[model samples]
Target: MTDVPSSDIAFTPRVKALQAQRGSRSAYARMEERGGFRTAVTPELAAFLAEVDTAFLATANAKGQPYAQHRGGPAGFIRVVDEHTLGFADFSGNRQYVTTGNLQENERAFLFLIDYAHRRRVKLWGRARVVQDPDLVARLMPEGYEARPEQAILFTVEAWDINCPQHIPRKVDAAAAAAALARLEAERDRLAEENAALRARLGER
Candidate 1:
């Protein structure tokens, strides 16, 4: 029996078999030899999380029933607590609590983060826990955001990998696009005034 590589937390024997069948195992094997997915947050990953205002969190119950929940707030809402941990304030929503219930039964979780404007995505596998401490929740909460914090969820990352930007359609944030349009309008007005002055000067000449 071939021992599993320590850095390869994502690929199981079944997954490897499929890769081999598809003729892609050798490339992955080379990757494994270098070192598989990253287990700790690097500088690049930390910067990416800073601009991520949205994420999808996936969890499963003890019975293996899976659920994915959408989480969103201002940029930097998902804060990196440390090299191995991530945290965010759990805002009150519809009170369904499906994610909370699943976590109680199963700690294993996955975080999917995508930056539409940049056409980049990241996948992280981790274990998560919910904290009801008011102090911790307050610390993670974003100021000036109109949302009531119900609690906090802390995730300890096990392994993570970034995917290529292929097939990711580029999109811009609504607020950012609006700001850019405003700047262009202002510049157009200024140029219109300059053109009128130049016309008057030519007439005088």
Candidate 2:
């Protein structure tokens, strides 16, 4: 496999240098020619993102200090504004504001969306800015969720890459599991009622 990612990838000089020292530069260069590196979101990717309710957002300040935060909501909380743009409603949380502050100094951001049950994940690199437009924020908000939308974050696509499922432990979404349980209970109740109806019909006969 090539060790050098595609040119669209946000691989910095420092990362390339490390790759050289680690003897992965040539492998990456060969690997760069293949894979789902894209400058815009594809239809399959949009559908994948719609199912992801959680992702890890990484940001760095002007001084290069890094901060990572977990963002989540109901499924499809992240909105695909276009093939090249993504938007999401930023909700109120612990008043830390690290992500907000970092974006101010440095717009560079990276996102990791993982489907643990399927052991699949996607990596997105872009520039992000927070906006307070009421109309846009409302459009991005997840329906039926109680979180208070504070603002909206728009991420301009630079590049994106899909990662292999290696090392990812198989896990299930809690909400999906709960929904499955509800369906099973409904099925059980329906069968019970049918049995009772048959017993009553036999007694009368």
Candidate 3:
């Protein structure tokens, strides 16, 4: 049996075999020697997550059927509960309960977070639990957001890694872009007013 590092939780024997066949095993072995992926949230990760407004939660049933669901809120919707834990308020959506049901059967889950504006992405492997406690759900809910909290999802991160921004299409947040345009228009108006005032003063001279 091959010994897998704690941080390399996703690298099973079959995966290692494929990597070896493809000539990538040596590089991954080097990574394992260097402690593999991160098992706890670093300050950089926390900051990155703080600005994440969108994420995808993926889960599988006991029979290995996979499902992915989109989760979005204002920035900082996903809260860093601790070094290895993340919590978020599960907003009342279509009420399908697919994710909740999958979690019950299979705790293993994954989180995919992408910052389209920065062209960065993060992958998280973990176990997830659905919490129906109102106090906990309320604590994770973002203030001033017009979403009803139905429950809370807590993820215990086992391993996490970041990917290079190779093919990610750059995209800015709509709200942020609109605010920038508004500021630019206001500045343009102010400059036009100042220029007109200077011209009037010169005419008076």
Best by lDDT: 3
With candidate 1 superimposed using the best TM-score fit, by how many Å does residue 143's alpha carbon deviate from the native?
1.8
lDDT of each: 0.93, 0.88, 0.95
Error of 2 at 6 (Å): 4.5
Put down candidate 1 lDDT per residue, 1-205, tens digits, no spaces.
1255534677888999999999999998987876677888899999999999999999999999999999999998999899999999999999999999999999999999999999999999999999999999999999999999999999999989999999999999999999999999999999999999999999999
- Summarize candidate 3's per-residue lDDT along 115-166 as a digit string, tens digits: 9999999999999999999999989999999999999999999989999999
CA lDDT for candidate 2: 0.88
Q: What local lDDT score does residue 74 receive in model 3, on the 0 to 100 scale?
A: 97
**Candidate 1 local lDDT, residue 51:** 98
The true-versus-predicted C-alpha distance at residue 168 of model 3, in Å, is: 0.7
- Which ranges of candidate 1 are over 4 A from the true structure? 1-7
> For all candidates, what are the clash counts?
0, 7, 0
Clashing pairs for model 3 are none
Residue 186 lDDT, candidate 2, scale 0-100: 100
Better of 2 and 3 by lDDT: 3
Clashes of 1: 0
